[model samples]
Target: MVISFLSALLILAGLVFFLGAGVGILRFPDFFSRMHAAGKGDTLSTLLIIAGFALYQMRDLGDSEASVSAVLVALKMLVIIAFLYIASATSTSALAEAGWEDGNDPVIAPKHENRLAGPPESRTAAADLNRNSTHDSQP
Candidate 1:
């Protein structure tokens, strides 16, 4: 019963991460901003959720039936964390390279800053196109 409750709590926390990611994707003004929100928020949130579940199952860790499953789940979580961190970092860098700015404002790639995105004109054009399609798809 206690384990079940903990499991529920952990899953709920994880779901919050998922919800956060969704909101970030929708609410963030740009691809770069969205990526930042999702990469950090979702990863930590899922880690917390998985840790909670691991704790919940600690009592059964030594059992012949559940030990293998628990270890496998834990290993899977580790792998997920590793891959996600790399992917998120690389993808965010790539997005910057592809000209994603943070916020809805026009940004000038200052000579001092290591800006990766393209010129304001191109980015604005893409933004306009995105806005058009998004608005059209709305109910």
Candidate 2:
């Protein structure tokens, strides 16, 4: 009874974390921040959900559930966690990349994706770099 109760509570908490992450993704003002919340929160939520499911299944399987099928199911769950970890990290990296396509990208970031704090470097360095690049391109 106690284990089942804990499992239910854990499942509910995991769902809350997942939903909160979705809201954070939609509401965040910048790509990096959105990706940050989405990646961390969703990963944690997924882990929690996986753990809860594993516990629930274990309860059902008990000594009987410890068969090969149960082992396979648990192993599959572990694989899923690993895959999500990699995918979330890759997607976040892609979001934070600055090397935009020359012609394919829009002229500017959407207001939602814009950051209030400018990049680490000031406008002077950026201008210098921009000018140097343009000068070099004038072949």
lDDT of 1 by residue, 20-137 (tens): 8889978987566776777777776767676676666564766697687877886776677677767867876776555533343333345643245355465559778788889999
lDDT of 1: 0.69
lDDT of 2 by residue, 51-120 (tens): 7776666565556735668767877887887888788778766655642322122234545332333453
Cα RMSDs of all predictions? Answer: 11.8, 6.1
Q: After superposition, how far is residue 139 of candidate 1 from its true place, in Å?
A: 63
Where is model 2 poorest over a 10-residue stretch in terms of lDDT?
99-108
Q: Which residue pairs clash within candidate 2?
A: 61-65
Clashes of each: 1, 1
Worst 10 residues of 1 by lDDT: 100-109
Measured by TM-score, the strongest candidate is 2
Could you tell me every candidate's TM-score relative to the true structure?
0.53, 0.64
